[model samples]
Target: MNTVRSFGFLAKKILLLSLITCWGISGHAQEQRPNILFVISDDQSFPHASAYGSEFVDTPAFDRVAGEGILFMNGFVASPGCSPSRAAILTGRYPWQNEAAGTHASSFSEKYTVLPDLLEEAGYTVGYTGKGWGPGDWEAGGRERNPAGPAFQDEELTPPHDYIRDTDYAGNFRVFLEQRPQESPFYFWLGTSEPHRAYEEGIGRAAGKKLEDVEVPDYLPDTPEVRGDLLDYAVEIEWFDRHLGEALALLKERGELENTMIIVTSDNGMPFPRAKANLYEDGIHVPLAIRWGEHVAGGRVVEDLVSLIDIMPTVLEAAGVEHRGEYVMTGKSLMNILTSSEEGIVDPSRLAVYSGRERHSSSRWNHLGYPQRSLRTHQYLYIRNFAPQRWPAGSPRRIEDGQLTPMHSGYHDIDAAPALEVMTEQADDPYFNRYLHLAVGRRPAEELYNIKKDPACINNLALDPEYEELTQSFRERLRGVLNKTGDPRVAGDGDVWESYPRLRGPMREFPAPEWVLPVKED
Candidate 1:
């Protein structure tokens, strides 16, 4: 009888010890997950950082990350616009797949689970500073906090220029570090609302920026005003880089730099005419650099086609977190490429990446949006504009208080900038008229550009007889991807895109299209 009792006690002791051992192993594994530092700038383009050998802008922090880890040459965002681009990054899906969240200033549906929430569920403390997943109403979408994470924008500082945001991004990050539990891994988003628009006129000139340093794109005129505007943009980029450097310094001070995966990129291209809201190269192509200490092999440059959608999967994989939700992510993880030592086209199967837009601003009649889908490959960029009759850059006229306003009073799709102002005000001038047309011109149903020959996307090869076959093949490829992705535009529900309400920004008025006119009584 005593031997029987002794055996039962031994069994219980072994079970309890096994449970305690499992708990310790689980806790240690959670702690071993690397921290994530995601830094995104407001409106920046690829090849702007000094690391890319740009003469105008100096970004030592971005350069540092590139030098220490890997620099991606062909990094593209899912969309050219801010809200949709950010939404894509958070959800690991295309803009159109995100429903209202896919469009600008629309609701982020509660159905779409984001990265920050996933990280938090995996025992990671996640927070964000500065802009995070917005210019839209996340609260209206039933989210209690910003999609990026909880906010850490309590700290402020005097900005060098009025257009620059006063949010002290680095300082806010410091506060976040202080408040974070010592044992937990963290995910922090450092978003900078810089180089967007509304720069102090001639601030760059006042700061002793030389016009000679500016490299003007073929789309815009190479005049003093444009150069100065670009310089001011460079100044803002520097400010963003400065804050990034400070954040890096803090991590180093805490001895956390070695264990953190650092990602630096932009939401979209520069906020210039034919750039920000357009589906051109400058719009969707963005700079990307990632540093993961010893995990990612250092001092390499990759030229593979990559999208911001990949960021979500990369983060989840790095943290060993399973993506659990109703929807599956469309983007594949970059872990294979990051961990590989080979540079320049690490993934040969990554043939092309896709980008599209619905509405940028309330720029059309009845608040209609310009719907476009594009497929970009190594040498070519093919675009399919669904609504060819509508103005590509919003209508030129607007109705005010039930009265028609002056001609050229609109074009709200283009962000108001000194460069745009010059183009419009000097539209009558022979030299500037061409630029004005380029900025607010009507686009064909299909457009193609040889990206290698014309990165500015000035030459359209879609209509060229020599490229007709190529264009058709690209169109079919785009269709296949769109259909596979369940894009509404290709699924006969394309009109539903325009029906999504613009939840934020001013709703402008324009003359209704003929199709919408009431039939006359005979």
Candidate 2:
């Protein structure tokens, strides 16, 4: 019996070895292992590109990619925040499954294997330029390099505006291509730090962009300040897209365009008060376009739900590499959805998608996390906030050096921007108070919304008797999946997320809410 078991184990190992050895063989060698160029923009949201019919911003490069390949309408990130969302994309797992890597600005554990490391082992030359898997300490996590790859940021260029980054992303990419060996295939990550925050006021107008072209979201007022902010965001989006066009042109100049797979998307949503950190549609939904030349069909629009984490497995499969890690991937490959001739809903089984959040900025007392999990389908959206007692954003005002700010002042979770500043200054006004309430108000544990009717997620349907059954069904489905995936939130260890040390960002002190008194011990 012992001999038979030994023989079976050895046979399995040999079969795996044979599969790995066949990666670069015969006619399929170069054809199967195509180069990967992944371009990511910071804080851009869905329907922002010209291809998506937005009149505000013109993204010719993104449109060109869509014209030459597939355009996705239902693509989302794993988290609403940057660090954890990037970590999830690299590891191909949910944020809750990865220990410290799952939290914002925390160290990533080396125990979890990332896509670049796995591809490097499979003989692919991997590297990255600009911002990659960051805003956190990767070195403290025991990684000798950035999880994305080696750095190639030796070049610089003067940006159009003062707030924009001077890192010449396109020039750096060209440098990387020049340095790479001719015979070896490469995986390059082009992460652009654009459209994030602290925009030079009225720079968009200075650049000849009209404020009237900006389409304000329903959650925000249609004031000039809001329109100006949106225009500035649009300007930055165009800047990033311009670099993408240059990179695509470079690939064409080198005759690698046809064989290379180009993926263009963003890390998270726009940097607005309620959009970037909240689990609303604008927060999680992002723009996505892919161009694979002749390997995949062009001018295709797909409506199937896809997650950012799916990129890890999709790239691995494209390189003819197999996954052999301890942690399991929660995302499914989009190869079938991409290769099919159909336009929308190629996979009916992809009925719903899931997303979760751990911690964003250090905006609260004790750095406590307002953990949330959500489920999105074609018709409806459901969300569960674990700590309903805690403020959804942060406290109204923070304390410093024995000074006190007035009521409705803090809301630190919301990023500081012109629109946010306007909302804060005009909080007492009748017209702006409703919008302000939506951005920083507390709520029930479970909230539901009809996305088709309320894409902004302003109305809560969980307590509506008309949709009681539907809400209950979605709530159970969300909890069941979390339990199945061993989510700590439902696995009796949800508090572990709060225990993780926040290694970066300022730690602000906030007074206890005037409403809640201290609990007395028994």
Candidate 3:
């Protein structure tokens, strides 16, 4: 009887030990799941961040992220405009893949899945502050919240400029963290609506920024007006960076810094003429910095091309989630690139990056877009203008309420600003005519530029005899990828992009340009 009692005690001890070991393993798995923080700024371009040695903007927070992890030199967005760019990032697909969401001021379809939605399904508490997936409506798609996530934008503060919004982005992030379940990880999108448009006149100069300090791009005139506008742009960008610093501090204080993956980037390029709405280097290229604490090595600069669409797959992979949907993603995960210790061209397969633009604003005939697509290689940029006859910057004049506006008055594609006004006023001057032409001129069907030699894209090489073979090769490659990815523009159903409903914003009428007036049935 004594030996039997001893055996029973031994059996109970073994069972208890086994249960504790399983619990430990489960906790270890939880620890491996890192929280994600995606920070995006509106209307910002690449080479503007301090890490890239730009003298214009001071982005210490972005630099901090780069110092701790990696700075991507060739980060490109799917679209040069805001709405489609955000849609592409959220859905992990190109803008053309999303129905109406592919254009500006349209609706997002319910068919495609977004990053936050997928992360939520995998047990993450998701939320967003400031700008998210918009300039478009998400409710029309039967979505419960913005595609970025739920809102956390209650807090506000007085802003330095009337153009700048007052949403307390960092404070809202803290609220999100506080309200989340202790055991569940969180995914937050801190999108800032800074550096867009309607900036306070002379704000940059008022802030003591020297006009000489502003480095004017070759496409714009180097006058005090343009320089002052650039300075004001810098002020707003810094405001976005300030909030980023606060958020980083909050995460560090909560002891969640090392366990979180932080990604910093922008929707597109700066809100300047010939930059924001075009497919040039300044329009599609954007700053990207990532930090994952001990998970990634610090102070690495990668030159490989990466697109914004990759964000969705990278986050999904990090959380061990699989995208098993019918709407396939064309982007590959950056996990391999992120984890690698190599600096330049970590992935040779990333030979090039692509970007495009559809209807950016209501600035065309029947709301028609200046449809353009581009392919950027290590040394060259190739552009294809589907409708070359349409005014690239909208018709030079518009008819409103049965009245015709004057010539050189309705280049609505360029955002209304002091710099734009200055350029228009000086358009006839031989000295400034070239700058005007670069901004509002009608483009050729095909344009090729050696990006290294002409970053501004002022010189076209498509018709040059020396670059004929290279131009043909790029054109073929671009078309092949577009076909493989099921892009409608290449699939003989390109008109469907125009068929998408513009659910919001005011519509305007445009008079046909001289090139198309002769063909008009009128």
Candidate 4:
């Protein structure tokens, strides 16, 4: 009997040991998950970072991230406007897939689950600093906080430029770190409001930036005013980089830098005419650099076409969390590309990326949007403008306080800039008129550009007989994807985009077009 008792006791001890060992393994696995530090800039473009050899802008922090990890040569946003672009990033879905959130200043629907909330549920202490998920009202969508995360913008600083926001982005990040539990991992978003608009004019010159060093895009005239404006833009980008550097320093100081996956990018392209609100190359294409210490191989440049929507799935995969949302995510994960040791074109299947825009600003009669959907490959960019007759930019006239505003005073879609002012004020000059028309001109129903040769989108190849077959093929591909993804524009509900209310921004009045009856004001 004593011998039998001993055997039972030994068995029980062995079982306890096995349970303890399993617990240790589970704990270690949890600790191995990396932290996420996503940094996004406002209104900055690709190839502007010094890592890409841009002459005018100096971005040591972005360059450092690219040098230490990987630089993506082809990174595009789902939309050109801030609200929809950011919404597409937060949710792993196309801009149109997210109702209300698909357009500028509209409500972000609570139905679509976002990255931060998902991470927070998976034990990550999520929060954001600076700009997060808006120009739109998240509350109206029944969300209690910004879709990016809970706010950490209590800290403030004295900025050098008047246009730059006083929010102390790095300082707030420090506060978030202190508030997080010691054992829990974190996912923090560091958004910069710089380079958006209202830059202190000529601040770049004051900071010793020469106009000669600035390379004007082909679409814009090479003039002193335009060069100076671009330089000022560079100054703001540098400001954003400076804060990013500080954030990195904080992580290093805390010995958390290596365990953190740092992602540096922008919401959309630079806020320039023919760039920001348009569906052209410069409008949607933005810089992207990812560094995860030893996890991601350094000094690699990838040329795969990637969308900002992929960021959501990538973050979820890195965290080992499964998406449990009801809505389907349209973006594919970039884990394979990110982890692979290969350089260019890591994923051969990633051939194209899709982007679209709707109701960027109250630009047309009855506040109608210049709805456009596009398909971009390495060699070509195909765009289908739904309302080709309507002005791509805002109308030439507006009514304010029951009085008619002057012509050229309307194009509010193009953010106020010295370059735009120069083109408009000198519209009579043959040199400036061409650029002015390009900035706010009406587009065709079908537009295609050979992106490789005409990156500026100066030449439209859709009308050329030689490219007709190629254009048709691109159109079919774009339509196929839109239909598969259930895009409202292609799903017989294209008009639904116009029905959504503009939750924010001024509602300007424009005279009704000749084709439509006058809209009565409520």
Residue 374, candidate 3: how far off, in angstroms? 1.1
lDDT of 4 by residue, 249-332 (tens): 999999999999999999988999999988899999999999998989999999999999999889877777778758868899
Estimate TM-scores for all models: 0.94, 0.93, 0.93, 0.94
Clashes of 4: 0
Candidate 1 deviant stretches above 4 angstroms: 1-31, 518-522
TM-score, cand. 3 vs. native: 0.93
lDDT of 2 by residue, 1-522 (tens): 132343244345434634665443334543567899999999998989999999899999999998899999999998888889999999999888888888899999888889887776566667788899978999889987789977777788888788899999999889778766565677899999987887888978888888888889999988999999999899999999999999999999999999898999998899987788888999999999988988789999999888998998888778777676579677788888767778988899988888888878777777877899999998888999998877877878778886767776667778888888787789889788888888887868999999899998888999889989998999899999899888999999999999998898888787775446687789
Descending-lDDT candidate ranking = 4, 1, 3, 2
Model 2, residue pairs in steric clash:
396-410
Worst 10 residues of 4 by lDDT: 1-10
User: Could you tell me the lDDT of residue 21 within candidate 3?
Assistant: 35
Model 3, range 412-484, lDDT digits (tens) per residue? 8788988788878877898688888888988889999888989988899998999889889999999988888
Q: Each candidate's root-mean-square deviation in Å?
A: 7.8, 6.9, 8.6, 8.5
Q: List the residue pairs that clash in candidate 1.
A: none
lDDT at 141, model 2: 94
Q: After superposition, how far is residue 10 of candidate 2 from its true place, in Å?
A: 32
lDDT score of model 3?
Answer: 0.86
